[model samples]
Target: MESVSTSSVMDILNLLKACCSQSCNYIMTYGGTFSSLASEVGQLKDKSSDVKRDVEAATRDGQTPRSEVLGWLSSVQDMEGEAESIERKYNQKIKCLCSFPLNVCSAYRLRNRAEAALATIRELKQSAEFTKLADNLNLTRSIKMPTTKTIGMDKVFEELQRHAKDDSLSVIGIHGMGGVGKTALLRRFNNDFPSETEADVVIFLELSIDYKLEEVQKSLFDRLSLTWQDEVTHRDRATKLFRVLSTLKFILLLDNLWEPLNYQVVGIPLPAPPSKCKIIFTTRTEDTCSHMGTEKMIKMECLEEEAAWNLFRNSARMDVIDADKNVRIEARDLVKECGGLPAALIVLAQAMAPKKTWEEWMHALTIMKDTPHQLPGMTNNVFSILKLSYDRLSSDNMRVCASYGALFIKGSWIGKFNIRNSWIGEGIIDNVQNVMDADHKTQFLLGILHAASLTVRVHDDYFTMHPMTRAMILWVQRECGKKENKWLVWDRERVEEAPAAEKWRDAERIALVWNQISDLPEAPQCPNLIFLDLQVNKFLRKIPNGFFLHMPLLRILELQETSIEELPVSIGNLMQLHYLNLCKTRITSLPKEMTALVNLKYLSLAFMKYLRIIPDQLISSLRELQWLIMMDSYSGWKEGQSCEGGVSFEELESLKRLKVIGMTVSTLAALQNLCDSPRLAPLTH
Candidate 1:
């Protein structure tokens, strides 16, 4: 080496040291590395077994293992196999001597590989310390509801669908009267929900008159599969509900909301601007819609004419309706009487389905027109269902007025002025001295009834009552009492004779208008009779002498459009009569006994063209009379002398409290008498 330097010698010695260190370490550490690898792999295997046991238990408990957990278990399995192979190879290597080059090399490489495997096993074992091994898989999102046949709901469905597509309309309301297909519409809507991207969950609840917050919460928890801890407070449950509902796209269909529901107290988060949640409810009153903060309201109306006929024809047997030409005519008339209401149409149709003859159909029509409550399904099925609306009225006066409205025949337009006067006269609207204020209050109450869907407004001056609502009122009056015959309404029917005497014994109100009765009951003992209407009996020529004997409580008596020519001496026995209508009758004289009517407030003698005589002081005897209508009749008036056996103008002017007076003045003297008296001029019509 041509005199090598000291630096070169140092470099050679360092290289030799590194090479020996590497080789010796690999060869010596094989046993320790192998032992460590086996230990770690065994630990990992134990952890894998533990994880597999946990996963199996979770599966039995209706849960699914996490993907990462399953992956870790697979890695551990691979690690175990590799460790076993490495152990076998190490054992073989150890059997040979460390002096052999091939055995030393093989042991060194195997030791390195074993150490790497051990590191991997350690990593897998650390990762195997999982906090949660599985996820719960029992949660259900939506349940389907039963379907029903629907007709004439296509337009309503289109409107609902249109509103649903609008993100701005989070809360929708369906408002209508009771028995007007509100519940049916809601069911249909619930059945047609949850498209692929529409909602993740759907819930339908019936919050009728009786619903509580806890009950509602319990239902929601059951649907959501939440742990409903009985001991937990409502606040805690609410919090849990909010937390869970916040992550879902949901729809809640609420049916039959009598009043506004408090969502905050129920823990239902308001759906809105960001979250995809919707709420829809059905109500009988529009005020509920307003109170519930509905963004869109769909009003339910009675079916149209064609639709009503179709529904009726289907509900009734088509064969029955089309049996004969006469049957078809009567069926059409019956359908007209239903006033296009689907509930009434269906019920009435079904009731008439079994009738085989036109005569039976005509009889059914008569009953429906006169006493609808007497129809087979009218009282129990139709009116009772509609009674809920009447019962939910806010005040007794509202309920009374609603029932009073039923006195008007179905489909007849009632003048607003007429109703107001009738209400005032019947003491329904009392204690208001100012006429304007009373009229305003009456309008306000009428508006409330209109909003409640009990009455349908026809125009600014008139409104009409639905036939089914009227029937419900009548049913309440007649059947919902111990005395089921309290109200006897037989108006505008083919009554050839009067009802039995027992039928009138406990009656409070009796109407027998537009009948063909030739004779009256000789003596019907109606002790509780308050209103007796015998109007429009064309053949009613005379009232028996004792007809009004036992009716001591009689207040309103109507004998208009009859053929009676004389007032019985017993007419004066009705001391409590507040209203008396004798218009269009053939009466010619007033009985002298009429002087006993002291409480008479309303007297109508309009169109009594044959009226020619008035007992002296007959008009003046009515000290409390406020309204006197004699239009187109009873114009035989004298100034001071009762010479012509007619009413005296001074006697008419004697009514100091009279507010409305409608009369005809056939003579210039009578016109001058009316115009000269300033007191009666303003009140005259």
Candidate 2:
């Protein structure tokens, strides 16, 4: 697995040239009789090849058996083996240089036998024959393809033909439920799209995961057989590909198109006025399909009842579908519960696949009856069955995490990118100990919530949760404030420890933690408390007394996590403080003395929660402060809260410590797109 760097590939090429040169020179010096054979071997090579262009150019012009003589010289080198055992056995290492697609072993076997036979010639010092043998060491490179076919895609051929015929500014889309056949279909196309046409170049780009515009552009440029040899940025790469597309008729299959992006801004052509170039795409939403302006949006129909029955038959493969009438009836009932979504149908059918009697099917049906469905336009009901796993968590963070389902309970496709942005904007994530490059802040939360079954990861970095799970989050948010399992309080047993850990955990737990807690906690320790979220809590009128001294660990302490409002004078003692988020809190203004925490990372003096002006010192001494989320969370005063990031990513770069972290997804599309974090391991709510 050596990296294919220029220096490495170049070094290899140099060594190969030197080996060929030595063999050729040794042959020409020989006064042997194998001249005719050498001439024949040299004739088989073309000048454009690596061996011919480099080695053949230097042989004595009229020399006939030059290579023939060198092939013999190879025996002399072998016999003069630095160590006697070198020639004792043929190692694959020697013959691996032979140009073949991993047939290095076979090449070694043949070279080994040649060595054994030529050992006699080596001992005799037949310089001519040894040179001839050396010249015979031919190595060439060959490309290889995987032998077996990738499974589960039956619609590839049809799509390929469609793309080929409509190559003029065309947009063919594939829309279906998660895990059905959209991505797989595109994958199959990626594998076999290049047929025989010279204008035929296929490039596949994923718009969901790792949605960096540069990545898409680079993939397209590479496929078009073009290279700038310069650092092509995200913007430039997109531009380069667009320029290429305008000339060459290429097949560009944009996968997981969820948003209505202006590709032109990124240097690619728009879909509205067809350019007579084929651009096939796949989306889960009809709205996205329409935006592409495709002549035909194949609204994928659900698997037919017969198709569902067959899926059940294949999955179950039991006698229930054959002999027992009552068993068959129950099996049919199971399929109905799956709603004909292929992913659900197969997953559900498989659980019952091995069952025999009617009673087992009946019990399963009973369980299915209990699970709830997502809201309108959010048909994520199939996995309500998975929500049962969340109930098993023992932690409040775990329970609060169950609320992730509520966002999806409404059938919202929470793209991973937008979710990451939401998590950051909402201030759910704080900092992490470099478990896996702390750069991935939200990923940790994703893993924890996913493990707790409070979130269901969907296609293209999108995630969702069942309505029941969303209900669980609401319950946890309400319960987090209770004295017994208060989400805002630090470990009751370890109050002097870090309330930041407790508060941070609770903040990340709620759909909007700032909206759940009334004020910051009073822990004597925990300097890692960077975020203070006072978002949703409506009960408070002022900050806790001496709150600043008690929470020296406070970075961003938001009181909006509950119904409380107010600011305590002791809030200024936090020296290591960073982000101070008081979005929905009822605080009026920061005390001029509290601006002493010169390390504030982000300071939001926004109004909607109704604060007027930032502390005069906050505008100056707190030099490192960056992001400011001052917009309304749905008019913070009343019930219908709007949770959106009011700050722009561009303006926040001035803070220096801030990074545009996480894969951000827009709320309008999907939520599951960004649930890639594994660090939120112990803190998922």
Best by TM-score: 1
Report the C-alpha lDDT of model 2 over 621-644, residue by residue, as the tens digit: 555543434443211111112424
State how far residue 662 of model 2 sits from its true place (Å). 51
Candidate 2 TM-score to native: 0.34
Per residue, candidate 1 scores C-alpha lDDT tens digits across 466-569 of 98788778778875634557877766666879888888998988878688877888889999998877888889999999888889999878888889998888
**What's the residue-level lDDT of 414 in candidate 1?**
80
Query: C-alpha displacement of 566 in model 1, angstroms?
Result: 5.7
Each model's RMSD to truth, in Å?
Answer: 9.1, 25.0
Per-model TM against the reference: 0.70, 0.34
